[model samples]
Target: MVTGGKSLKKFHDVVAPADAAPIRTSYFIVIFGSAHLLLSQLPNFNSITVVSLAAAVMSLSYSTIAWVASLEHRRHGGSSHVVDYSMTASTSAGRTFNFLSALGDVAFAYAGHNVVLEIQATIPSTPGKPSKKPMWLGVMVAYLVVAVCYLPVAFVGYYVFGNAVDDNILITLEKPRWLIAAANMFVVVHVIGSYQIYAMPVFDMLETFLVKKLRFHPGWPLRLIARSLYVVFTMIVGIAIPFFGGLLGFFGGFAFAPTTYFLPCIMWLIIMKPKKFGFSWCTNWICIIIGVLLSLLAPIGGLRSIIINAKTYKFFS
Candidate 1:
């Protein structure tokens, strides 16, 4: 998320000033340095909720702009736009790797179902019967939102940019500086807010371990120091290797596949105690097998992409 914010800022900086130099260490140093100050002020969970809501609003706006722009570009016969939606032709190994990488991308898009349970936990249940209505409602709403936001942009952007699309779609839209800048600005804000939301769990775990296991005092000083260090470490890592898509692919396949697909099946079996060799049991096992295979194999393509990209990129270039 930090890398995303940095990339968008770099995008804005490059176009605004028409700078020819590549994004440098100084840019990241300044950005992350400023980020430290921003994060330091966000002390508690309640404060971050407002940030998250703000991010959601920005995200909705940006997504709408992207979808609309993509359609307009394609409809108006923009340069580089093509009707060829056929398979990408390449060597067998390359094709297979690209397919795997695409799977990872899909996984990344669809991941975060686990968060539904977390959100559901906060919703009030009925007095007598445990209400699953709220949870399912949330899931349905989330999926609908994802589909609405993703499908049009993915289809129309591909139709417009074809194989020439940048990793960041906003970068591909060169015209209408005000629109692109607005979209990128929101991208930065949304990512910054999202970084906090995602990282808060890790912070909670680390602080719990420190205070309980290591006997550290549970105070603002320790919290500030630990959280600051964590933020710095993440920024350093982001600066060192700026491969967002590859990282998404790797994590989506290796971690999210299991969390989203396999673990749920296992949990279902344990909870329901279904027939040992029933149809439901067999289906769950098949899902588990597929999930396991995806987790093991899909990351290969992501790793390969990382290596290939790394060769052309300097430490901060």
Candidate 2:
């Protein structure tokens, strides 16, 4: 809302296709797959594994359809609506109401996620023209509409079921057997589709690292090992441990912290003290500050995550 969607979308090109290569597709798959595996193990959602998987698969199918449509529009040498946005969420810990109130955490994530999107959007489009506006506006509007849609669903769900509306909104409102069946169907389809989408970045990264950086021959042991290790890591995290808090916090703190807390502070510091250090002096200060905050919050966040879980569900031993 602070910035126009047009202004916002021009930021995606920040991550160059070449530079993004090392990220490895296997890592993404493992992470999402692991998340599925982890969530599946949870008492509430464990039974819904098949449904969740189906949801992920649906996401993939939707993405394919969307991508093909995009290609078609591209060939037409005109334009179409493509809304891109990013989201940030608490690690398995959720928001620690003590250190950062849920309000603060949510605001931080929203802002940080936006910055990531900005960086990603920095890539140039075609030769001369930048990406367009109506498309961006449509995205912004749709986000609002979706939010609007959610409000009614939230009210109806809570009013109808009280505390039953717990971790997942659907779980509360799903009173009918047929609805449960349909929901399960949707979930499995969604998981496959979404997993494939997240896997792309990891895939591109691993491929680039192997082919270009390490110069490993096709199907070489190194490449094979990398893929195998990545897959194993995914399963370990996805199934064995399934810790969301650490993963969420690590990325949120490392990536989002710089963009949100540090960047603005650095920008302010630069204007305030440009000649003091002569090189990203403000940014350096921000980095140090963030380091200190994260250091302090790391243990705090961890403890808070545990306490919060204890308070809510006796899932812990």
Candidate 3:
């Protein structure tokens, strides 16, 4: 939602610069949340197939535009901005913290792992045709797509903009105004689907707790109230503290690194019991160590960044 707001702002800046008064991001967040109130009502994961598909396409489209336009900018010498590849931070401590936070950002990119099981659950499985087969294929294809979408944007964008780039590459590109505007809209659409994908699991957990533990009667009323409340709570929080990069770094390392990086490897080791000091054992151990370190260190940097930003930020402004 925050990203969508930024995109909308970028679009507004392009289309109506004369009348583009500075709007608070919170308003855009509310608009984004309002759309989700309707989308969150979708019954289950399978029901959102079309939305998910469109989001995936939008992601690819915007990502492609980001890098391609970056290359064009560099090639055309669009700006006199000197591309400096040096460290963005001035001090050692700042550099270290930024480095750690960057690791969290990288970890955040793999956050789709959190919903893998839920998505697989939606797939049909039979004795003769297990779901894992198709799931594995899908996972491989998804990873390939991620690699394609992410790598060029990361490498080429940095190459072009260097350390001066914004947290969002789209924000840094200026010329080709219409294209940038379109890319921002694509980002908005993509994040809408991404938000729903991440929220579906939380919704399920909330509904389960209410139905099983609290003994709420299972019906549309329960779902409506529970899901609406969940959306509103998140919306309120977003409005309150919409620190995009900081939040990504914090949650990425705090929540995602364990599940995405190490937990699966640990589970494999425990279930398969690979021979001690063997390749699989050693690899998994290495992964665990790295993931553990990421989980421990990244949040500190993220928190520090949030503090630094919060010092200047106005509440809901």
Candidate 4:
């Protein structure tokens, strides 16, 4: 719930919801990728710093991907007009079961993440509202800045640990136990923040059900009731799932198959006319290919570990 809240809220906005889903997903990818850039070299994240770090990251990704997607749309014969429309992909039996193999999950997860917003991101606009600020140039510049910041850090991290790499930065730093503890603390806090931000809407979803179906009034007392139920839901996930890392490892790895890697380029392809598939299209295709490759490898790792390590996977294991 905590991570969900922060993540959800970071991308959350009911008013201009069309942008929310892709923005949220891209936010995760940008942060995830940026953290990797620093992994080999840099100082660890403290609470305050990570907040700023993530914000800049979110901005960069939101801008960069938005620009690239827009450019793709424009080149494809649509005006670079953008709008926020929400869409969801199926996660049930039909398309769901075939995605079970970690290999399968890779395909699914990748597909799912992509599916989360594939329809909207590449679609051209209706000719109505004035466009918002142009983010591509600014965001492109930001990615360059972030990349410069990250490259050195990755090497440093590698230097700190050669063959015997620790699981986290803190574990490797002998004297700086504080750094280790602080980084963990930031991540924990961030997770909580993301959950609250993300799942709060899920709570509202539940609340509406309660108020409408159960005949509760949609006021303070109802809100409290809804919140309490939401809290209970959190407890269940925490207790039942215990740690979500393996779960995310499995799920994130799982979703990566369809979502993180495959879907965007595919969507672009669908909307793209031949004249549009020029240099950037080729670049994105390479990236999509690389991501798909990595995503494929990841699911195998996840499935093996998920099957053996995760008791939760016993149903499948």
Candidate achieving higher lDDT, 2 or 3: 3
lDDT digits (tens) for residues 1-317 of candidate 3: 67777777777777666765777778888888899999999989998899999999999999999999999998898745777999978999999998888888889987677899999999999999999999999999998999999999999988998888888999888769999989998998998898899899999999999999999999899889999999899888877777778877888899899988889889999999999999999999999999999999888888888888899999888
Winning model by TM-score: 3
Q: Is candidate 1 or candidate 2 better by lDDT?
A: 1
Model 1 scores a C-alpha lDDT of 0.73
Per-model TM values vs. the true structure: 0.87, 0.43, 0.96, 0.43
**CA lDDT of 89 in candidate 4?**
20
* Highest lDDT against the true fold, candidate: 3
Global CA lDDT of candidate 3, please? 0.88
Tens-digit lDDT track for model 1 on 1-317?
Answer: 43565546655564666755556644655584567556754655566777878877777887888878777776666654345555463688877887787788778778765455545555678876565876787678767877887787888788777777766678677556677778877777777776776666667777889999999998888788788888778777677667777777777798778888789999999999899889999999999998888898779878877887799888765
lDDT of each: 0.73, 0.41, 0.88, 0.42
Error of 2 at 212 (Å): 4.7
lDDT of 2 by residue, 1-317 (tens): 00111111112112235355343323433434444433322222233445545654543443333333334433554233342222233453343433443223332333322322332354355545545454466446545643454445444443433442332333222223343334433433454433333333454467678888878775545544665555455554443322344334444444445555556656657576666666767556756686547534644554454455446542211
Estimate the lDDT of model 2. Answer: 0.41
